[model samples]
Target: MRRVLSGLVLLLAVLAGTTAAAAEPATETVHYTFDGPSPLTDVSGHGHDLTPVSRFGGAFTTVAHNGGQALVFPSPCHAEPCPRIALRAATTTGLNPGRRPLRYGASVRLAADQTTKGENVLQKGFSAQGSQYKLQIDGLAGRPSCVLVDDRRPQIHAAISNVGVADDRWHTLECRRAGSRLSILVDGVTRGRATVPADLSVSNRRPFSLGGKGSYPDNDQFQGILDEVWVRIG
Candidate 1:
């Protein structure tokens, strides 16, 4: 009878430990549909909303797309202090999943004529400052790419897709970082993949940004339309 009681106690302890571990805050999601009347509202329940920054009064607007409204970026500028426009989180808190798995992406539409050397879709932290995780369209090809910088060491890993998304059509682009791999997916299809440190972590004070980094020059401003944007970390 004593042995049976001890065994039962051990089983309950094990079950309780497992349940507690599962209840830990290991997963978080923030989503911006951009379909609502106010683009700052976060529909993902995590309440990671955004604040807008623009150089011009009406540089950024919204248009109907996918049966709902979508955010539109400003046109390309070749001069200094151009019409800067972007959306940024009020704070960086809980947005960086550190070394844990992370996925971020957006539904984008851009014309070939609007393509630039680089168009930042979203980013947190700067590569030169500690660590960062970013998604962007690169070069005149308007190729989608994902970049991850490790805070444990000086490392910048990127997976750039060959598929050009700039053709005046809407496309879903996803950037995923898991374990030792960084991948970019277009329309739920894998387009590129690369390797990185498995235990890397990215933590920085920079605010999470969309469309561009701010009004600063060479901000990698995005020029196009963005529908649903989301981030998931675990």
Candidate 2:
């Protein structure tokens, strides 16, 4: 009888351990889906007087031929490849920047034939003049696949890379920042790890984009589909 009781207790302990592991905090999702003739209308505090660019400009829009709206840059700051998807820290109306201990994740469909040049699909510290940090995705340019840089030391800090992520297909990439340690995920698998400065914050007041720019390929135009961009805070 005592042996039977002992076995039952052990089973109960194992079940409890499994439950605890399942309850661990997981990455959450924040999506800004887009679709329409006026695709930028989904964002708040936007006005009608702003100049329009192509079919996918303003705040958000669906302007690509891939049956989904994209963040389009018809006429970029410089001038084919200039199309891009950008994110800015807009606080006029004051929306809470989600939770703390933030992690960023995204599922993107990139242009199959051509991809971002000079580095990886992920680039940081992107200012028209210059930036403090940069994460370059170099596989798009026929280079070895890896996260190019972690440029967030001074003002810009903590850059990550999902090394095996490729364009022309849907991929899920994630970056987790816990204290000073950083972990990157590509296709739902952890690919790289790094230590970041405590003072590092990659958030810039300027807007950041995907697909198009002025630095490479005449204009940095992103030719693809992107969806399910999620920023999680632990």
What C-alpha lDDT values do all the predictions have?
0.87, 0.43
Q: In model 1, which regions exceed 4 Å deviation?
A: 1-17, 23-25, 56-58
Clashes of each: 0, 24
Off by over 4 Å in 2: 1-30, 36-38, 41-100, 118-136, 141-162, 202-204, 208-221
Candidate 2, 187: how far from true, in Å?
A: 2.0
Cα deviation of 111 in candidate 1 (Å)?
0.7
Per-residue lDDT tens digits of candidate 2, residues 110-160?
543444453323333353433322333443532212221222323333344
Quote each prediction's TM-score.
Answer: 0.90, 0.51
- Candidate 1: the clashing residue pairs are none
